[model samples]
Target: RHQGFFRLDPHVDPISDGGNVFILGFCSPTVMSLTPVGGAMGSLMNQRAVSTKSWAAKEDIDVLMEPRTLCHLHGDARQLLNHGIRMGVDAAQLKKQGVNVPDNASLYDWWGGMTSPVQRSPMRLSVVLAFADVDEIF
Candidate 1:
């Protein structure tokens, strides 16, 4: 069912496995929670790239970056172009019902990608980004 969702290529460099992080937060369904913890986590992950001395001996740096790079290969390269198309169409449909998204705010990419299907493809991440606003929420 996940077919045609993503592609994997290994020629890319800076691959790492690091880890697959998933976060789920519970809310009252009325109030939106925008926390700094997310940003702090991102910063820590980025630091892993520079902290070559630590975690280096435990894991290969190249292997650590794999999941991130592969995720990007899945579709991030085309995100900046395709994201708005999907968002705009939905927004237009909503506007017809008097629900219009803010002009300064728009849907943004959070994360979406397919894992490498090939058995030999190295572990890596394709890409990662953070987005804010109502468009992204809905």
Candidate 2:
């Protein structure tokens, strides 16, 4: 994902949010700056961001997941929050943009340890599973 790229699922209905979402991360050659910025908070500040039309009293992100992580969001987490990569997430660009290094960008310190090929590479690999039905499991 790029520094400017981001997404928020705006689904809010009973048993909606596509039932549930599971993200399995992967990378044959992992890069420190390629982790996804997830927003799994049930609400913003104090208000809930359930429906697409519902505006929150405060629009603050609540959580961030690590690289090579398995994230599962269901119930209120899936229905009431907009969970996914947030904007300005690129670690390199963050320095140029003068944005403070986000707390989740822990890999920045490990940049010196990356292998030569992986150091120059920028990639995001992960399998995202959405629960459709029990039959889908088979």
Candidate 3:
């Protein structure tokens, strides 16, 4: 479980790790956005060179990850793109903007889908699993 605002900058796995990473959303239904900056070209500098082209052509490639969603990042997607959750304002600000910030009971129902509500906290959890090749490690 994790809480608070964060932005993971664009990066590739230095250890290689089979050039793959998986993220499974467990709770909270907020949208996760991914932007593919460019095709993997071995280094960040090379990736940036093509970023303009990628951004111009990125309209159809942006992804919105939903709750219970499983996302796979590999190859160029893993090495040349950036993904992050939107940082929402405080509850009061949200309410002022006409967003219904869920109360504990509502949040409990939203997460658990149970008639009996349980205490809820501002926690969002996602499990990340990375895989690597044995030969690469050895």
Candidate 4:
């Protein structure tokens, strides 16, 4: 599974920001499914699996730095914070632009289609959405 996050306006209440963040992540891959079809009426029945890594609060992410399962960091807190926040924002923006979807079908059918692909591809299992406002499990 792929993981990601976003940095919201701290001014937004924590719960509301967190909820929107979660929706933003959940709605992301849904929007991706809207892709391949150009938002038409097809489905991603042909694709494979879809999985996402969990969301982590800024503090939690900081703690993960000790082991650093994710590579490519320069070991700077401000940089990491900036990167994570931007990732969340970019995930949101990507949804707006249309990317990372299996097909252009309804959410249920799209999910159903993803659950059962015509030709299984390990690549599909790697697909995931990320955002900062997102909460754990989103």
Top TM-score model: 3
Ranked by TM-score, top first: 3, 2, 4, 1
| Runs off by more than 4 Å, candidate 2 | 1-17, 28-59, 89-121, 132-138
* Prediction 1 TM-score vs. true: 0.15
Shift in Å, residue 75, candidate 4:
9.0
> With candidate 4 superimposed using the best TM-score fit, by how many Å does residue 20's alpha carbon deviate from the native?
34
Where's the lowest-lDDT run of ten residues in candidate 1? Answer: 80-89
- What candidate 3 gets wrong by more than 4 Å, as runs, is 1-10, 37-62, 89-121, 133-138
- lDDT for each residue of candidate 1 in 39-128, tens digit (9 for 90 to 100): 222223333221212212222112112222322222222221111101011233334446534333222111111111111121212234
lDDT of 2 by residue, 87-115 (tens): 22235444444545544432221122212
Off by over 4 Å in 4: 1-84, 87-95, 102-138
User: Backbone clashes per model, in order?
Assistant: 26, 0, 0, 12
Q: Of 1 and 2, which scores higher on lDDT?
A: 2
lDDT of 3 by residue, 90-132 (tens): 4443344455655322222111111222222356677878886
Worst 10 residues of 3 by lDDT: 108-117
What's each prediction's TM-score?
A: 0.15, 0.41, 0.49, 0.16
lDDT at 37, model 3: 52
